[model samples]
Target: MYKKKYSNKFSVAPMLNYTDQYCRYFYRQLTKKTLLYTEMITSQELLYKNPDNYIRYTSNNQNPIAIQLAGNNINELTKCAMIAYSLGFNEINLNAGCPSKKAQLGGFGACLMLNPILLFNIIRAIYNTVPIPISIKIRLGTHNKNNYQHLYNFIKLVSKKNYCKRFIIHARIANLNGLNTKKNRCIPPLNYKYVYKIKKDFPNLKIILNGGIQNLQEAQKHLKIIDGVMLGRAIYKNPLMLCAVDQKIFSVHSIINKKILLDNMQKYIHYHSLKNIPIIYIFRHMLNIFYGKPQSKKLKQYFIHKIKNYTDITILFQKLSKKFNF
Candidate 1:
């Protein structure tokens, strides 16, 4: 499939520590047709290390998958973008919005906001080399809301070059001094109005709102105003929320059902285990699938620590399903 057809309008945000290969495979199974993204992989990590294990995506699924690359050096990031393109990713998202000390020290992530010129060049290089759609994911501002004008200017430059198809705005500021990344995700008040303003100003460019969106109702609200909405922590903790995505967002026939979803999860677990991924890596996220069901607390607690083998985890899941009459 080509570019426009891959943009599903609603997607699960790329969350670190949570959206790994196994997680994407499982999420793809549950959601059936939604776009899935790999967690942010630094260009340095991809080039200097073995990324095969990290960036694996099965061709059989043919799910619309995007790879997010974060780095500062223009040459390194461009090289990584080429690598991702060569690997057949439908889209490549540059991470300009992570609030972490390490990312700052690396001279990338939210810090890229400071050097929009360099970012422009990086985007230009990626666009020049890769035929896939290129996009930017960023926060509303780095330190002050007033910097939005600066962001708008960057978007103007990118759009003027016809290099960027979309801009995903995480409705929060990066507090470089006081807050950690998790706190940054929560402590900063989401100002969707700022995003709405961007949408109004740049009618030619697609503006995507991300962060703090929880359910389909909230997604519908944003979809009415912006081009798209991205779900992060909410989706990871409650992945079933995406089950209705095809019907709710894409206006497509829905193939997602509870039984089919579980079978899909089991299939991925088997595939991941064959690849030597630990059972806990797959089971840790599945525990949330049954979240809020009767006996969920007990089952979550049991699986959280009691899981020692794949067979035992499968048995416990079966027992929990029976206990909750699922």
Candidate 2:
């Protein structure tokens, strides 16, 4: 049912602390067809932390979404995948590409590439349990080595018996030491060839290219070689790009206006505010809505001031529309 409405050609990466329920709500208003990913949740968190707060979603036309989980334990990963499947998520993606310090300490993320068996077990466990598809996000290699053969072998071993259905490859090697995630993303050079080669080798496997793709043209170029494209900061920093992506790349014709985005967000803001959810949690994301528009800085300042006393902010959009002459 959900598959009929959503497309995965352009997916927003699972950025921690950035992609949340409130943020997803905002992005959905910009483009209905693009797949929205949840922030990285660990198997431990899904079982131990309050799962409702971690994986909440407001129903809408953007029905096809993926939940990204970071963990190496087979039982724990499987349990979390089943829960996500039960919650109506279309896909459960294992976080094999995250290079954060916290992720490394937890025995998950990009470091999973070093131990293929553990990764295989986790993937197998998730795929065996739920009918929902399983995907993996991975880097070319860890420890500063851009080895193609090793990456190919890792994918080969993991898919020895058709364990995973899709693989999202970030076109850079993850450095375990010395480089933080922010630096890792930019410092390491992107090698799109490895991802393309993977597609050539694994013809039946669905391969998605990620890293450094910022515009529709770049996405279109990569699509010629791979099955899909996944983007992170490029989309978050400038969300209007997704509107272009929906229309141009995927041929999805849901062009949402800025006013409509604000209108829809008002409903979400009201519901959450009544639940005592801090107004900043939702408004902080709105700060970048007008990326290149005039009076953006002024609007951001206005939101900062209003958040101080945002008890009745349902009409915040109306105020902005009138102030900007929208």
Candidate 2: residue 115 Cα off by (Å): 1.0
C-alpha lDDT (0 to 100) for residue 166 of candidate 2: 89
Cα TM-score of candidate 1: 0.92
Cα error, residue 27 of model 1, in Å, equals 0.9
**How do the residues 235-325 of candidate 2 rate in per-residue lDDT, one tens digit apiece?**
8788767767778877767656666767777877888878988888987887776677788888779878977866567666677666542
Index of the highest-lDDT prediction: 2
Local distance difference test, each candidate: 0.79, 0.83
Number of clashing residue pairs in every model? Answer: 0, 0
Structural similarity to truth (TM-score) of each candidate? 0.92, 0.94
The regions of model 2 sitting more than 4 angstroms off are: 1-6, 59-62, 323-326
Q: What is the lDDT of candidate 2?
A: 0.83
Q: Lowest summed lDDT over 10 consecutive residues: which window, candidate 2?
A: 317-326
